[model samples]
Target: MSRRRVQTLPRASDDTVIPDPEQRHLLWARGYLYAREPSEPPHPWWRSHELGGRTLHFDPRLELSVARHGETFVAVLGIAVDLSEWLTGLGDIAEMLLDHRLRSRSAMIRALDRVCGRYIVIDGRGEHAWIQGDASCSRPVYYSTTADAYASHAHLLAAVTGSPRHPRFPDPNGLGKRTYAMPGNCTPWRDVRVLTPNTDLCLTTGEISRFFPRSRIEHRDPLLIIDHLGPLLERQLELLTREHRLLISLTAGLDSRTTLALSRSVADRVEYFCYEFPEVREGRSPEKQQDSEISRQLAERVGVTFHTVPMPYRYPEEPLLSVTRANATLFSHPALGLSHLTSGLDDRLHIRSSHFEVARRWFRRHGATQIPVDGKEMARLLTEYHGNEAPFVEEFDRFYALTDFESTEDLCDQHDLFYWEHRAGTWVPHFLAESDVAYENYTIVNARHIYEWLMSAPHRLRSNAAVQRGLITRYWPEAMEFPINGQMKEHFPAQVACAPDRASSRNWSMSGLAASLKQFLRGNSASRHFR
Candidate 1:
């Protein structure tokens, strides 16, 4: 609803106290301040809009004061959450407060333990706090004690400090480049780090607290996990569905398909949209045509109100930069192109089609289960077609080395021995990385993580492969039997018709230029230029 801040100052002695202490003298300070129209409010605040919900009690007579102690100041925060009785199962605010108390032991911890939803607290008495809720994390809290007042939303923080309107004034290069905010989290200013999900912070004694640990869902079975997910997703839809009308970017792909199907199940009405580039259609082989036809037929059969948005393959080069720059914070080049394509729509539920196959292939290739292929050999395979371009080969190696799989491999060795043996264990971390990256890339994000989780849960529950098969069977049963009996004609037709074209001089030239252009545009600008 509104941004809130809690500022803490030292408690002065009875009579002989200096009223104007230097701004630097204060030890701990934090508070919540928010601005919202009396009408449309943001979430957890929206929950309290009615008379039954919590309302802000503004005290005009209360003078804004700062107190100072030796080196530390203490401030207590009282945060209130407004929820109807029906929504209590979704972690009521009071329950969160109680849980915070149990998890945090110190006085500063006790103060933060009371505040629920998304929050950031800094006590002049030597304490700091940050927290978020379970389903949605929309509230943004940022701080900078470098200025006289440490404020929550970035713009407000700037306004209060009389600083420039730049989002990067404090840390010009770093924060400017990182734009997408993951739902349900906080990224404090440069000096103040995140407290992590289900965690709290108490700067007083320089101690951070954990209200909940990462392993809370460790023993959950597929059905139980889905039960949790169904409600969480339902809550998200309910919140987004408020304006009645909704738009979905649908495709033949699984991610968007699942989102469209789910939205159809819940929303009273819906409008489905898709982007069809003529170039893709014009060059389409028989199989590609078949896929496109199937997608059209499926959308029609589902009775969704469908609209096709046609975007030409070519555009002026300058606008490309503007489009890509808009999304630089969230996506890399490949993803930035897609985001630019969807930027024209006003749909509330902007669905994206993403798959984990790329990450899966990377892991499967590198993991022990696969036949051992030396990095040099893979590098050769990747570069042989591009002539003897040392630079291109070097860049390819760097890209592969930078991926999360390199680190995940180490983690797999240490903690996922069972998965390593069973050939199924990299699912959680793999899916998390994939989902987080996708969310960062798109504006309104949705994915198949729920299904992926179901598929990867313990064998006694359901394998991740099973979920994939089930979805395929449930929606497109007709295509299920096509590859039966080793039918190469139907399933491997593309591979059969294809002959590797020898690389021409022009091909080599384009490859070099693409590589160089890519390198030149490194960072956000590069992604925007190409995308």
Candidate 2:
């Protein structure tokens, strides 16, 4: 279906309301805090309904609530939260956001520091919008030249502007899959820009600055960092527990084992479950029998309830298309179908640990000790991403320039960032529910503090997920007793990275040839082999 058809489609339900024809002339948000006056005359969709010197607009589907304090304005979405802890005695969230500092003892620069889920804080005085969201970009923040003064949703920008559909810079291969990132804040369209994680773009000065974890791994013992990571995760889960029934997913890998271990503080409060594609797993990479069984054993060990949630192997085509549309086409290939099987999960929120495995990949034994990745391999990956050798190789030099200095001490250094950006940044979002149903989802590692500690830790601590091993030892030492994915690693390894056997596409498949062609016909241009 075309973008216009999506915009014009009648309201499917109360949760999703379509804008009237006239209102859609220029992208605008209504009903939500993003409500604005109709545009002057010709571009009636956007009018001069200025709120404190700024024209407000955001995605209409957002479960947003608006509030004001003095010259500040606040709009929050995704996670339903009360900022009292982060804003205790701090008064209004808007005020704290506006001052960019707090009266409390907390650090000032990280104003939105502990706030969970996707959030946007606006300074009514200067119209300085501090927009931030989860690592998955579930609510992709977009900007275009036509609306150069501010940034909004991707679909909104595409609707109103002549945003050229071109990427100014070169990106890596398999963009929407598990391999590469959006590349230098580039999105599917050159005209529309994605506010990449760690970046905060100011509407007033148009200044974009780093807005992620300000802390790094402390100069502490590896064991100590492991201790710190466990509590840090508990705190995050504790924070989320206020509004969500934690659903800890156990799979055949280390990610789940680590997550479950760290979640010990609230084990009783959480409900553990296992999900797998038994039908789809037939020909290649079938789900291991011991995988779910181990998970059940682990849950029993934790003394928390564990249930195996069955998923469908053959997803109906139309529903898949709807999911594709809802996810903004950021998801393609085999991962798309997996979303259906797991769609029934509700009430319980998921803290996906898929991307966290990248850090651990550093330690696993790969063919001979890491061979420095060559430019030739890099070019090959890029060519595979665009699916066309000509346009891909033409800019191979640009791609090289963009990821310069990528090859460092370890093989992971060669792939970790891209993996984090693409797998976590792109694929993880698709795993989340695309419908209006309010099943909240977040990444296991989006918390800035955790990221800082992990990145700053000595490489040895993170390699082979040495930190996870330490966490498992400190939290759930018995995990060492349970065979992880049929292997008794003295230390925990990926239970099935993407944890919960999210590795549906790990191996290259001949079936991918047909799947890629279907995706192409469905409007995805990413390479066939990469998918």
TM-score of 2: 0.66
* lDDT against the true structure, each candidate: 0.31, 0.47
Candidate 1 local Cα displacement, residue 238, angstroms: 4.7
Misplaced by over 4 Å in model 2 are 1-69, 72-75, 80-99, 102-108, 113-116, 128-130, 134-139, 148-156, 160-184, 211-219, 280-284, 287-290, 332-345, 361-423, 433-438, 491-531
Model 1, 1-531: lDDT tens digits are 322222322221212112222311110111133222132221121112111111211111111221223323222222222222222111233333333333343533433322322222223322232332211112223333343232223433443444443322232224232221211111223332222222333322334343321122233332234334444443444554553245666655544554553454443466666655555568655553444555566667656677766544433244343333221222233232333334454323333333322212333333333223323333333332223244333433433232222333322221122122111211111122222211211212212233223323333223122223223332333333332222211111111112122112112243443454344334224232120
lDDT value for model 2: 0.47
Q: Least accurate stretch of 10 residues (summed lDDT) in model 1?
A: 45-54
